[model samples]
Target: MARDYDSQLLESVAVRRRRMRDALLFGAQRARRSTDERLGKVFAGIAIAAVLCAGCVGWSFLQATLAQQKQQQQQQYGTPSAQPSSASSASTSR
Candidate 1:
């Protein structure tokens, strides 16, 4: 009878150990999944920021080019000689 009891006790301990190991493995897998999800979100945010920065740089360059074109146009067509007689006389008075 004592031997049977010892055997039953050993079996129960083994079962408990197996359950503990499974729980530990499941917890580790869950942690890994969570970490992967967070990393994906972080990389996505970084990509968006990079794209926005590029867009802003492009817009600034476009604005500068437009301004330069406007200045060139003014110099070409809107010179002092192109002014009306009244406006030029007013400027000389000033």
Candidate 2:
């Protein structure tokens, strides 16, 4: 008789615990506070504009550096077109 009462008590406790878990799992599953969707779009637009501005600045710097190097090389070796006759003679000899 004591063993039967103990078994019944354990089964009832187990059933109550299961019901509490099920209720918590499937209840009040929505967000408590919501945010503006436009905030995300504004951030995205700013990110894209920053990337474009960086690209433009980088391209201009590259062009200026290349131009400076070309000018230095021209000063060191002189212009190739400065002596047309030598170029023609070299080509003809080859």
Candidate models: Cα lDDT each: 0.88, 0.80
lDDT of 1 by residue, 1-94 (tens): 9999999999999999987886776665776766888999999999999999999999999999999999998897867556667797889999
lDDT per residue (tens digit) for residues 17-37 in model 2: 987775675445323212333
What range of 10 consecutive residues in model 2 has the weakest lDDT sum?
28-37
Query: Where does model 2 exceed 4 Å of error?
Result: 1-35, 79-94
Quality of model 1 by C-alpha lDDT: 0.88
Please report the TM-score between candidate 2 and the true structure.
0.46
Error of 1 at 55 (Å): 0.9
> Which candidate gets the maximum TM-score versus the true structure?
1
Candidate 1 clashes: the total is 0
